[model samples]
Target: MKPVRRRIRRHFGLTAKQVAVRSKRPWYFQWGITVLYVVFGYGIAYWQFAGAEDVHQKLRQTALENQTLHTKIIQVERQLQIEQAAQTNLAQQLNKVQDENMHIKQDLVFYKNITNAKRLAK
Candidate 1:
């Protein structure tokens, strides 16, 4: 039986030929695997970061929209209160006018009675 000697380049560590001889994978394939893993890691990070930014932007926009809607509601409420106050003032004025008309009618009736009595005396 012959004793097999370890090759001198094998002592320096694995050469491309040695790795191919042992694992049957080409050097380019190994580099491609490394690049693929790097690209996949970067892709995951990019999507996660981008999604977080999108959510944050939506939240900001929603807050602004909510503020705008709330201001509009406050404005509408104030307008309704002002309109209600005006209606109340107008109703009070109408009651005052009706009372004044009643007084005038009573005075006219009293004058008619006085004239009828004077004509009878004549």
Candidate 2:
């Protein structure tokens, strides 16, 4: 029984309770390290926010450029529509002139035939 108890105690690490000892450091040194960590963290946060502001500014500039391009596209489409309409009107006018020229040629040919017949009969 005694051997069994000794083995259990050794295996379980319950032979004795050990206390840990630590050397105390000065409070000022701890406070100084804490302040330095806080200042460093704050500086990093400020830098990140400054970079974000630049990114936001660039995003706004790009948006403005996109809007300008969209406006120009609309203007160009309107001009194209106007030019197409003018071309259609010009084509219609040319067709009308061709038809008028064909009729005038037919009349001239008829007049020439009549004059030639009269001369041959005389």
The TM-score between candidate 1 and the true structure equals 0.55
Candidate 2 regions exceeding 4 Å error are 1-47
- Candidate lDDT scores, in order, read 0.89, 0.95
lDDT of 2 by residue, 3-96 (tens): 9988877766667557679988899999999999999999999999989989999999999999999999999999999999999999999999
lDDT of 1: 0.89
TM-score for each model: 0.55, 0.60
Whole-model lDDT for model 2 versus the true structure?
Answer: 0.95
Worst 10 residues of 1 by lDDT: 1-10
Predicted structure 2: clash tally: 0
lDDT winner among the candidates?
2
lDDT of 1 by residue, 55-103 (tens): 9999999999999999999999999999999999999999999999999
